[model samples]
Target: MMTDLHVVPARRGRAVRLAKGQAIQIINTHGQQVVDTWCFNADDMSEFMSMEHLHATLQGIFPATGDGLTTNRRRPILILEEDTSPGRHDTVIAACDVHRYAALGCTQYHDNCTDNLRAALGHLDLRTADCPAPLNLWMNIPVSPDGKITWGEPLSKPGDHVTLRAALDCIVVMSTCPQDMIPINGAACTPTEVHYRLIA
Candidate 1:
């Protein structure tokens, strides 16, 4: 089935269920913003995501086309179908939580990403009781050759996006990043959108 394309704004939330072989595009409408994303196996919620495995398989710091995003059990969850030509996304940065909020002097924004995640899960009839770690797309955090990581400027531009193809029936939860306390998503907390399309 082909799903109509939809656009959502930054700091907004969207939930989607992607069947095996389907593709989803998270669009950075205004650019320089991060999108926190998470996924779970529709058949088994316990089979969560494994960033370590994904990084291992991808064999690099950032995700690129043809890289396989793996789950906790070392199973392929999604495939990177496309990425911006000059932009590089960070997979090491975990999703925002209350602790990070307090450290960033934006404790008030604590619920922003969390709220989006919960809302997305609720849309799929799922619960936060099993919320899993998320992936930060379009976030540019540079790591030194010595392993020191620094939050860098935004690497994406207007209309930049990352596309992923589901390898299994999965529930995807995402947050149009509202991070204004850091340079990762730029100083402005702009909005983003998610576009879905079925692949034949």
Candidate 2:
């Protein structure tokens, strides 16, 4: 099978279709950046990958290798094939949006994941609510004993990546999280790269 590669610019997003037995690799080309990611059943846009369902089924808050990320209907969508980061990917936190930035007081045209996903999936009509919160790759959102979640710089270094195998034909969407207001990207955002290919 031929390999497919796509570059996702900083503060932007990209989308791709994956057949079963295929996998998508997300590269954190520049360190300290986060990629907001989610996917859907290629045959049914309404059936989306759900972080909640994954937690309920896996009995864990964050994903682990060998775990299958599931859809809202509890069907497997993708599997966590490999993780080469420091193991700090986040399942908590919603994708960044204008409203979130507005609440943070920088309301003027800030690049965000919500818009990126919508733009990337141009063929589909999606509302913010329609898109669930994503698997935050390279994002460090740690929960303190007090139960407060804090955003910190990623544990991932440059060139680190994670791969997800499609359990079904799927539509994968991702965004280079454009959050400069916080330290999630170490105060700067950068471009990301994605590679896709068949596994066997």
Candidate 3:
């Protein structure tokens, strides 16, 4: 059964705590918005879902249903239980930050996934020293055979979702990407809200 639904507002983030065996269903309500996701051990913040470790563990960049998302210590922290979309989550990009925006030619501060993660954790009286690369849900970055990657719009339709089961007691964070500078969210470059729920 699922509990009350929660919303990750556009250009912002939210964090939820899950017990072992529980799962989170993240819905792409508007379909095109990219949700930057991260997971950390509740008892030990340093041990977080690491894209590098996951790459080595899965022996691939794209994680599919039933694949274990590994932590920095190379242990499973969550399982990709179900994916209703095209199963094209990204593992290669770093979360967007102020520096990234500046490099993009922004003259002033801008909302970014990195700060969103920090702010989300701060809401729970939690803090971490580093920001690990995020699992870019619904963001499409196509790779060429010659080591080139091209940003593309999301392929998921409205209401598509993915369910991730907690392998350990952990905190999962989601950020509705605010990248208006690119078409990663969609061809229109507009980010929208997403909904999620805790499943028992």
Q: Over 4 Å off in model 3, which ranges?
A: none
In candidate 3, list every pair of residues with a backbone clash. Answer: none
Query: Residue 100 in model 2: shift from native, Å?
Result: 0.2
Deviation of model 3 at 62, angstroms: 0.3
Residue pairs with backbone atoms closer than 3 Å in model 1 (clashes):
9-192, 10-191, 10-192
| lDDT tens per residue, model 2, 1-200 | 44655677777888878889888887777667788999988888888899888889988777888889999999889999998887788888998888999999984878889888889888455434466889888789889889999878888887787889999998888898888777888755444443333444
Model 1 superposed RMSD (Cα): 2.3
**Backbone collision tally, model 3:** 0
Best by lDDT: 3
Which parts of model 1 have CA positions greater than 4 angstroms off? 107-109, 128-131, 189-200
Determine the backbone clash count of candidate 1: 3
- Quote the positional error of residue 71 for candidate 2 in Å: 0.7
| Ranking 1 against 3 by lDDT, winner | 3
Lowest lDDT block of 10, candidate 1: 191-200
**How well does candidate 1 match the true structure in TM-score terms?**
0.87
